[model samples]
Target: MPRVGLFITCVNDALFPETPKAVVTILERLGYDVDFPAAQTCCGQMHANSGYKKDAAKLARNFEAVFDPYDAIVTPSGSCAAMARDQCPHLTGSTIGRRVYELSEFLLDVAGVEDVGARFPHTVTYHPTCHGTRALGLGDKPIRLLRAVAGIELIDLPAAEQCCGFGGTFALKNSEVSSAMLADKCRHATDTGAEYLAAADNSCLTHIGGGISRLGRTPGAAKAPRPVHYAEILASTA
Candidate 1:
């Protein structure tokens, strides 16, 4: 078994801690040794997206320095994995970027295990975040894993390839456009009649979930689909 380091991104560490916990649970069950490097910090995605390239470069270098020793660095966030894989090389001029793997990619490609023995009896729909779909090219890796789960009804998300409009700082700087995109994404998610909406990146989930909640509270609005991180659903049983 390879020594895998879990790179829990800033948002997951601070806001969605359970997502990483789920990654650990599922990986451990698959018989890999997973380690969380306490020295790990932000991937500097926010800084880079917010036009602080120098600061983002510094943090990217910091990320490489911290996780370079591990056999493989696995992260639950596709956006962070995309950053390390796509941007870290330009920042550090190092090939450590190649070692980073997003959660589903690691399981399906690296670990080579699919039926992870998880069972979640819910009608779930998956949202492929922009980074996961376009940047990482994680096509159907998440869907494949979700399909193998014993009791999950994984439904197709309309416009599954569209952005959730939570491009790190993109949401805050372009609130009107971001909200419009998010509303459209939420409508598709709810249209699936899925009890839960799953995606690899919690940042996107946070944005779409907020919209779902708002819609739920609106007058004459139907129940909105609840957003859940894919890892959380994979970590569940029964």
Candidate 2:
């Protein structure tokens, strides 16, 4: 019965709108009252990563203004969730950061339910984004949720902890090195023979997905991996 604000991270809004819809639908099914303010936009992770702390601080204030009324805030992207959970507090001692919860973390802790009643008859592998793993310490929360899905065979991705090389603006700054890093991660995913490559961040998925599609076009290169955001998968059942 928690009142929650859904931070439909920028990328999810601009590119992957379905992700946030899935997030809202799932939260509703869990009996939580979720509100999505149309005024919400980018969490400023992109600006912060690019050394634009001032811009990020402004974005944080905007977030605080839009979301402070809720008991807690939840987001679909691990990167955005980590920013709210880990970075927003530094901008100001605003209560928003203290109350912010990533979707996986919220589902496992706040909602106190491991099984979200999702169903997917596909063999999938999970790739834990670095922020979800190291920053937020959301170990196995996603796995716990996905396992409860009715028909999914979730395989453990090889080197699942490795970065997909989409560290916000990391790919733009070092395209070659980023491409190399993603190639390795893609190879590991393909090696597992998983039909879908799942992760919590669409930004990372976009980057890795780009490499996957490019590789699919190349001779002898691996086929493209379908990147499924954790929220999108969860929404599938809702």
Per-candidate Cα lDDT values, in order, are: 0.89, 0.83
TM-score of each: 0.97, 0.95
Query: What CA RMSD would candidate 2 show?
Result: 1.5
> After superposition, which runs of candidate 1 have C-alpha atoms over 4 Å from their true positions?
none
**Tens digit of lDDT per residue, candidate 2, span 1-238?**
7789988887887899888888888988888888888898677787887888999999988988989788888888777877886777877556577778888888888889888778888888999998888888888998888888888888888888988887878888888888888989988888877889888888888888887887788888655558888777777753
Q: Return the clash pairs for model 2, or none.
A: none
User: Where's the lowest-lDDT run of ten residues in candidate 2?
Assistant: 90-99
Residue by residue across 70-171, what tens digits does model 1's lDDT show? 889999988899889888787778788688999998998988988889999999999998899899999999999999988889889899888988787888
Query: 216, model 2: CA deviation in Å?
Result: 1.0
RMSD of 1: 0.9
For candidate 1, what is the lDDT? 0.89
